[model samples]
Target: MPITTEKEQLVAELSDKLTRTKGAVLTTYSGLSVAQDTKLRRKLREAEVEYRVVKNTLTRIAAAKANITGLDKHLEGTTAIAISYTDPVAPAKVLSEFVKELKGKNLEIKAGIVEGKVIDANGVKSLASLPSREVLLAQLLAGMQSPIVGLVNVLHGTTRNLVCALEAIRKQKESA
Candidate 1:
């Protein structure tokens, strides 16, 4: 089949985005109201995630071009893709939160890809359950500093005991 230049461009764009993103969440927006969809888009945008209602065929082609597979089976139904370029869990986290807020209505996750690994709804939820990048980094930093902090406290303990003993001795001498 001869491809149109416009479609080629669209596919190229999608493939580029797909190739660059760390995670992609495939979802259905079937029964969401305009207000809810707008709110979702706003939230996703704030998170620096790209959300698009892409044609399944174009998505398939783009996925193939990007060397991403295993999500084609999930391309069925009213599919919209939420893609994150930096944070691998942002899209999943946002979508899962939104789904929960909506009471798991029309807005539902189908499948997802995180760091090139395909995952299902449960996997996406699990990913969402994880802390954000900043939080994880903070946790790592705390972990790295704990030993040093403990060592410093341990090193100070001898001086503390010495000072206490000196104070006690001084008090005893004054009493005598």
Candidate 2:
């Protein structure tokens, strides 16, 4: 039998989200209480992440359609996926922080797909260890600006030297 229209629609929506996502972290929310869940959702939302509890079967189909492989193994159990469309590291950071706050409760990161690469839980944590996207971009811009600043200073030094030489020559001529 074919899948129902609603199911197909859900899969399509998930697949589209997966396609547009910069990164996604899949975790099992087994023992989470309502309050903790709400707090976690709020944190993720503040970071602009989309968190969804997905049916593993439909999610598996959607992941494959989105060209994300190696996730099927991690799709088992009570799976929730956190998708970050803008900053690739936001979901990982938020999820890791929540896990730490919970003292490593039933919230377990199974796997992640970042920039089209599937990684394990350790990899996800490592990603979280990185600075935020804005910080990284600022660092890059500063690094790139350094050379330009150095060149401008070098040009100014040459002009300064020429002006000093001219001034010295004028002083000598006036004395004569």
TM for every model, in the order presented, reads 0.87, 0.93
Clashing pairs in 1: none
lDDT of 2 at 30: 92
Worst 10 residues of 2 by lDDT: 1-10
lDDT, candidate 2, 1-176, per-residue tens:
47799999999999999999899999999999999999999999999999989999999899899998898999899999999988889999999999999999979999988987899999999999998778899999999999999999999999999999999999999999
Q: Pick the candidate with the highest lDDT.
A: 2
lDDT (CA) per prediction: 0.93, 0.94
